[model samples]
Target: FALIHSRWTRRVTLLKRALSEIGIDPRRVHLEWISANEGAKFQRTVSWYVNEIKRLGPSPVAEVVDGQA
Candidate 1:
């Protein structure tokens, strides 16, 4: 997902610990950097995550653990 693509890379060293506090799966999120001028690259990035989520159906990371809020 595009949820953390921006900040994850900037703070990857601390992402997992941060995610643990919020019940999110870092693996299910993707962080990529595409140059602003690289429209094609951006499109491909979007498509990739879209297909990934499609295959994953819905994310269970947040709701499967004893009714996460």
Candidate 2:
């Protein structure tokens, strides 16, 4: 479990770096660990992330892909 957690942490860090390099907000990425019994926690996490994404507004990468950038 420790090894898996370490690997995921490293992967997430790398992902954030790649996103930043591509001009995307690193805050747009999220990583959470919730057990199967934590349904409420999962719901709350999803809700919070949704609100955060809304607060961040549309991604700049989307505009570039749509040829607007």
Candidate 3:
């Protein structure tokens, strides 16, 4: 578990950095370690993330696409 977590942590760190460099908000991205057995947890996490993103209004990328940025 530790090895898996460590590798995932490194991957997420790199991903966040890359997103930031591209002008994306890193907070909009999320990484969660959910086993197949954690169906409820996975559902909850997805639901929460979706709500959070909705509350953020819209992505800056979308604004640029709509010519509002």
Candidate 4:
């Protein structure tokens, strides 16, 4: 479990870095360690993330694709 957690943490870090390099907000990425039984927690997390994305509006990458950047 320790090794798996360590590897996942590293991978998430890399993912955030890559997103930043591509003009995307790193906060747009979420990493959770919820177990399969945590249905309520999963639903709440997804709801929170959705609200956050709405608050942040569209991604810079999307504007670039639409030629508005």
Q: Write the per-residue lDDT of candidate 4 for residues 12-63, one digit (tens) a residue.
A: 9999999999778899988889899999999999999999999989888787
Whole-model lDDT for model 2 versus the true structure? 0.95
| Local distance difference test values of all predictions, in order | 0.72, 0.95, 0.90, 0.91
Query: lDDT per residue, candidate 2, 18-41, as tens digits?
Result: 999988999999999889999999
What is the lDDT, from 0 to 100, of the residue 59 in candidate 4?
A: 85
**Which one is best on TM-score?**
2
Model 2 ranges off by over 4 Å: none
RMSD of 1: 6.2
- Model 1: per-residue lDDT, tens digit, 1-69? 366764566687477567766765555667677888999999999999888878866666546655873
Clash pairs detected, candidate 2: none
- Model 1 CA lDDT for position 24: 58
Q: 1 or 3: which has the higher TM-score?
A: 3
Residue ranges of candidate 1 with Cα displaced over 4 Å: 1-10, 16-25, 61-69
Candidate 3 runs further than 4 Å off: 66-68
Roughly what TM-score does model 2 have, to 2 decimal places? 0.92
Candidate 3 lDDT score relative to the true structure? 0.90
